[model samples]
Target: MKTIERRSTCPINYSVEIFGDKWMLLLLRDLMFNGKNSFLEFKASDEKISSAVLTEKLNTLLNEGIVTKITSPKNASKFLYMLTEKGIELVPFMVEFLNWGSRYNPNGGPKTLLEKIEKNKKKAIAELQDNLRSQRHSYTNNPSDAF
Candidate 1:
């Protein structure tokens, strides 16, 4: 019998190790698609994630360098969490998952985005990347400029 060494440096495995959980992906989906930033927004999503679980997922994402928490300029008491470049890079994985779900589940999500993604995956990825890049730049230049 031959034993294979697990590669720790593989990017795919690293991503999976950090964000393979169901709720983590859902949280990222909320950030990516819905443009949610606040804790209340995340909690009040269609998925209805609990407060405690949401906190845990957010912390995990932050620790994994997938998400960053920024203090709200308008309200000093609140924090707005946004995805990092690494997190934005998960768009393709999200699209593929949505595609698979739509195919098997038959009533997964909005057919328009899924259809658009299926038809032109490159365009979809590009749009997502562009959006993330612009948002990140704007946020960095002016912390108040967030979607």
Candidate 2:
């Protein structure tokens, strides 16, 4: 019998450490799908994350370099959060989750998105990245569009 050792400290384990929590993925999902980018927006999610939990997750994501907060020019007191490249790179993981859920759960979610993902996995991921890049550029050039 042979025993296997982790390769380079387990990349999946490291990611899971940062985002394996119940709501962390949901937070990422909202950012990826619904374009949510603020404390208030995340709080207003249909899943109804509590304020404390949301705060903790947001802080954790920030500390992990997956997200960054920029002060809103229109409102000095408010901040707009966005995914870093590291974060946006998780699209495949999210897509896989959606595909798995669509297969196993099959109760909710946009069947159209799921079908697109299923039918054209590569194109779907590419479109997601392109959209994120466009959104980032738009938000930076026109901060008001951050909403």
Candidate 3:
């Protein structure tokens, strides 16, 4: 596999090189938060990402093995995109970002989400991780559907 040449071996630099884009993070947000499995669904996000940009970000994540695109079993013409095991493992980190943003930003997101994160921080992360981990069960939305 090809690797990105960077200035140093710092872990933060490596993480940024792989996932620094705002749009890509939004796509992951949609997948992990909104249960968006379709291109249309991703495109319909509040951020309104352009088709070209979305395609590029998806390809990058796909290349990094952070996500997988599989043909929809219910409809061959469609595709379902989900986080890979590696991506699923990022749930806690992502949740931490959410927590950080809610803390610093004056205008917070959903109150329910904030309250849950505050009230049962560990439990919330565990539940989310459990959901994404279950995606290995072939072609089933059973994992993310509960969210």
Best by TM-score: 2
Q: Which of candidates 2 and 3 is the stronger one according to TM-score? A: 2
The residue-by-residue lDDT of candidate 3 on 28-138, one tens digit each, is: 788787778788899888888999988888887888899898777766787778899888888888888888988899998768766888999899878877776665454
- Give the root-mean-square deviation of each candidate in angstroms: 5.6, 6.2, 3.2
Q: Which residue pairs clash in candidate 1?
A: none
| Candidate 3 residue runs with Cα over 4 Å from true position | 1-7, 135-147
lDDT of 2 by residue, 21-132 (tens): 8899999998888888889999999899999999888888888877788887678898877888888899999999888877887485777787788789999988997888
In terms of lDDT, the poorest run of 10 residues in model 2 is: 1-10
Best by lDDT: 2
Q: How many backbone clashes does candidate 1 have?
A: 0
**Error of model 3, residue 9, in angstroms:** 2.8
lDDT of each: 0.79, 0.82, 0.79
Q: Per-residue lDDT of 1-147 in model 1, one digit per residue for the tens?
A: 222244588978866776678898888788887778789999888888888889888888887777888777778899878889988888888878877887899567867777778789889878977887777677656866653
TM-score of 3: 0.85
lDDT of 1 at 40: 91
